[model samples]
Target: MAVVEIYDTTLRDGSQGEGISFSAEDKVKIALKLDKMGFHYVEGGWPGSNPKDMAFFQRIKNHRLSHARIAAFGSTRKPGVPVQEDGNIQCILAAGVSVATIFGKSWDLHVTRALGTTLEENLAMIEESVGYLKSRGLTVIYDAEHFFDGFKANAEYALATLKAAVRGGADRLVLCDTNGGSLPEEIAAIIRRVRDDVPVVLGIHCHNDGELAVANTLAAVRAGATHVQGTINGYGERCGNANLCSVIPNLTLKYGHETIPRSSLAQLTDLSRYVSELANLHPNPHQPFVGSSAFAHKGGVHVSAILKDPRTYEHIDPALVGNRRRVLVSELSGLSNLFYKLKELNFNLDASREETRRFLEEIKELEHQGYMFEGAEGSFELLLRRAYDNYREPFKLESLRVIIELKENSPVYSEAIIKLTVGDQVVHTAAEGNGPVNALDNALRKALEVFYPDIRRMQLTDYKVRVLDEKDGTGAVVRVLIETGDGERSWGTVGVSTNIIEASWQALVDSIAYGLLKNNGR
Candidate 1:
């Protein structure tokens, strides 16, 4: 089997993205996870840039990594500075990481404009910095920054810079598409030219400005590149880096290369979602392999075909990437789609000709009235069960009141009182929270806890609000979607009302009801 090394720069380049920053603890945790996932190299940030990165080097020393060798990133020696006297070079050596990667100018334009130095001087900087790092016994990876653009503009100078690094004993030469504007064919052509001319192991680092980073990377691998650099969820500056979530699965399943252990491939979905949460960024549902909607079938015809044979609609088995096939029900859903989804909920309703029409009509009517069943499966299941069988209510709401007050010098306070009846007992509870919706959620949970203790375990994970008509301004009817989790799985519920608080409260009630129903029934 061919060995294509996976180099993760999420902790370094990924953090360079706008609205993205990781704490020292976040970096350590992510580094450990990458090591667990068996990446060949994990690049921590430049230690000299910030205290957080410096602290990461000290903090990571406490635990031993299993697979990944941590690498420290830095730039080449300055124009007038000696390798030994340069602050950046000294910091790279001081970093406790096992490997060192230094980026140098490969583009003559950047060399002239950014560095304001002669082309020959840049070559000397690359050679001295790489040689000094290699002399320190650190595995050196020389990143030929903007190699693709430089190769297009002046192929001779770019090749000269790489030759300088090789003369300095750099182990690997990484060609970077820093501008991310190179097409796959252009990348393949340039890399092939470099391979025929240069005699070093090649790697590729791409940006997605052209939306072709993944394609260009695959082209690089196909053109004899042995190492690939990317981030977990493709998180990086500008348009982001090549997505490893897509790259790993494509390599293992499509190209038949074992970049990581085959068994570890199943953890890809979890790893992508985990990093997104830590970064406090909402996961992209449409991302290739690990996204929520990657394997989800929504069209009525597609859902029906998938129900008969998933291969009819799917390209590859979703289970191979730790993703499941989902059939979503909506106005576009046919009767088969509804039946298929009901089966997932463990409900076997008799879908006779007449009954199917009745259920479909009701679903279509609800969808026409601002209800979306695509994300709210719990609500769909409850509605499905009710249509087929005698549905039982776990609790009944009697009354509710919410109060909000703005203090002169203090923060606003929101309070709620809820009265509910469970079996023969009526429970009343009052609670205070940061907002009116939160207060209602607190009071409802408190009242329900007396009857169903498991309600305490359910938490609202996400809340999305959408206004139906912006022309109405404050009087606009808003829809609230609340996602609830029980430490294991998640379900969504939705409500619509002119008052945002009322809509939130309705969704909150449905969330608790669905949670209690599922737990008690189980």
Candidate 2:
């Protein structure tokens, strides 16, 4: 199998994105994860730019990496400065890594306007900076920033910049789509021309401003580039960088390139989410391969076809990327969706049964009334069980009351009182909370915990309320969705009502009931 190198810059380039900030410890953690997954290179950060990056270098030295070579990233020597005396160049050498990646101006516009230097001096900076790092026993990767744009404007000057890096003994020549405006064909054509002039190994780096970074990178690879640069979730400045989460699968599964170990490919989804968590960003559910909704089927026709063979609606087996196929039940769902879900839950409800047909109709009616089960699988399961002949109620609600009080110079007070029967026992409880719904949740859980102690393990993670009709004004019906988790697993439940408190109570009760059902091994 032919191999292509995978270089990750999430700790460096990705952190430049808005709302993304990683501590030195976070960088170390991500680097180790990349190493474990067999990435060829991990760019630590610019040591000369910040103390956090310097701290990263000092901390990473304590642990030995298995697969990835940690590369220190920096720019070329400043114009009119000696490479050896340059502060950025000195930091690259002091990073103690075997690999160093330095970028220099390739476009003439940037040469004069961005760098404020003569074209000849820019070439000398690229050569001397790469040469200095090479002489220091570092494998130098020279990035020709804005190479695609430069080639389009002045092809000869761009090729000249690459040749300069060659003369400097640079190990790899990376052409960057820094502006990310180049098309795939443009990338392919430029790389083909550059390959004829530059005799070094080639790599491709791309931004996502044009939303074609991954496409442009693939074009460069087909045009003879052997290395690919990107971040895990495409996190970067401006729009973002090329997402390696998409690139890796496209390379290995679609193009047949050997990149990461095929066995380790299953870790891709987990790795993407782990990085997003550390970055304090919500995972994009619609993102290509690693997203939660990547393989989810919703339409009745699609679900019916998917039941026979997943390939009917899916491009590839989701498990190949550490994800699974999901059959979502909604107003658009058919009997097939219910069947698939029931099979997953170890139920044998016949599709032709009258009760099954009525159950499906009931779900449709609920959805028509603003109760969407697409994101509320926990509530769907409870409804399905209720239709079975052997089903039994876990607990019964008798009455509930909530109170709110306001006093001058004092914070508003909210409390809830609940009465419920568990088997033959009646338990009543009262609790105070930040709000009426929270107090209701607290009081109900407090009442149920005596009978089901495992309920203590469950906690509400998210609560979202959507108004069904904005034109209905203050009397509009609302839908409440609650996400609950039991440390290891999480599920969503939903309720719809004209009263917000009543809607919240229904979803909250279903959440606890479903949690108890799972804990009881039912």
Candidate 3:
């Protein structure tokens, strides 16, 4: 089987995404991860664009990589300057990489209007720039910018541009759909034409404006391209670039093309989450293959059949992508669903079927009262433990009070006082924080540290709020969910109240209780 090479640009093009930025250290860490993951090429950044990118290239000199070659990206030499004299060329050389990728204009309109250079001069620039790089003993990959749109407008000019790169000693010619609006069939047809005409290796670089970047890139590959360029998680300018997370699985699993090692397929979900957290971004729930909701079942009938045989509802085993099937416990759950959840909590169900039915009914009533189990698995586990009489109280909440002081000309200040009992000893603590929720969390953790020093190892990682009954106006019920994690494990708990502080406090208390219980194996 022929293997297509994957070139990841998450640290380069991905950083171009709006509201996204990665420091040089962050770029180096992600680059190291990609290298270990077996990407064929990793584009670190454009050396001249920013100080951070320049620092990245300088810092990577001391490291060793297993599988990936670092590629420095830049444009072709300026319209008239000698290739050796161009600042972009100098930066590319300073990057100290074995391979360099340079993009040149393929459209006549761009050459004439944007570049203010004749089409023939632009062609000469392409040839001279690539020839100069090759003359320096560096492998060059030429990017033919706007190839698809240019081909539609003037097929001769676009093909000429690619031919110039090939004639000038480029090892590969990457045809780029820079604007990212071309369809799969259009990409396939153009790639086929180029493959027949240009003898050099063909590659693809696609953006995601039309949401067809992955489709178009795969189509180009089917038409004989061997190299694929994309950013991890689809982070890039505008609508973003093709997502390697989506492309890698599609190629290896669906199309039987070898890119990443077959055994590494199972690490997809963890890899996705790792990158998202490192970037301080949330993962998209609808993302293919590795999303949290990728295999979630909620409808009663759907869950019923899935419980019998998951293949009835699922397209593939989620474990293949490092994700697991999740049966959502909601107001719609039946007795079978309750039993399934109980089994997960290691609770033995009684032989009385009526009791199970009563449990399901009560779950629905609680859900209607603003309890949400989907995001509060820890709370659900506690409920199951209580139902089976197997739960032990880790600590007792003696009292919790929030005091707020408001002045006419001063900012309001809130302090939380928490009193707790652990093993016949009572501890009291008070703290001030930005809000009632933060203050309460601090006070509780402070008081608990005396008894459970291990509490310092955990933290509240995420918090979310939902309005359960908007029709009730100020009297509407609200649900709060808190996600906590130690270095190894993560759990979530939920609480509901009309008062926001109360809801937050309830979830916060459950978070600590669940952590203690799990730590002690209670």
lDDT order, best first, reads 2, 1, 3
The model with the greatest lDDT is 2
Off by over 4 Å in 2: 450-453
Q: Write the per-residue lDDT of candidate 2 for residues 336-430, one digit (tens) a residue.
A: 98888888888876887887888889989999999999789899988888877366778989999999999999998999999999999999889
lDDT agreement with native, every candidate: 0.89, 0.93, 0.87
- Model 2: clashing residue pairs? none
Instruction: Write the residue-wise lDDT of candidate 1 on 152-270 in tens digits.
Output: 99999999999999999999999999999999999999999999987889999999999999999999998989899999899999999999999888887899988988888888998
Q: Tens-digit lDDT track for model 3 on 1-522?
A: 569999988898998998788888888888888888888999999996777998999888779999999999898888888888999988998888888999999988899999998898899899988998899888999999999999999999999999999888999899999999999999999999989898999999999999999999889889999999998888899999998888988888888899988777888888788778777897877788888888887777887788789899898899988988887778987665676676666666762478777777777898888898887888877877776666767788888899888889988798999888888888888999877888898898888887888799889999999888789988888999999998877888999999998999889888988888888875
Candidate 3 regions with alpha-carbon error over 4 angstroms: 350-352
Q: After superposition, how far is residue 368 of candidate 2 from its true place, in Å?
A: 0.5
TM-score of 2: 0.95
Superposition error at 32 for model 2 (Å): 1.7
CA RMSD per model (angstroms)? 1.8, 1.8, 1.8
Error of 3 at 408 (Å): 3.3
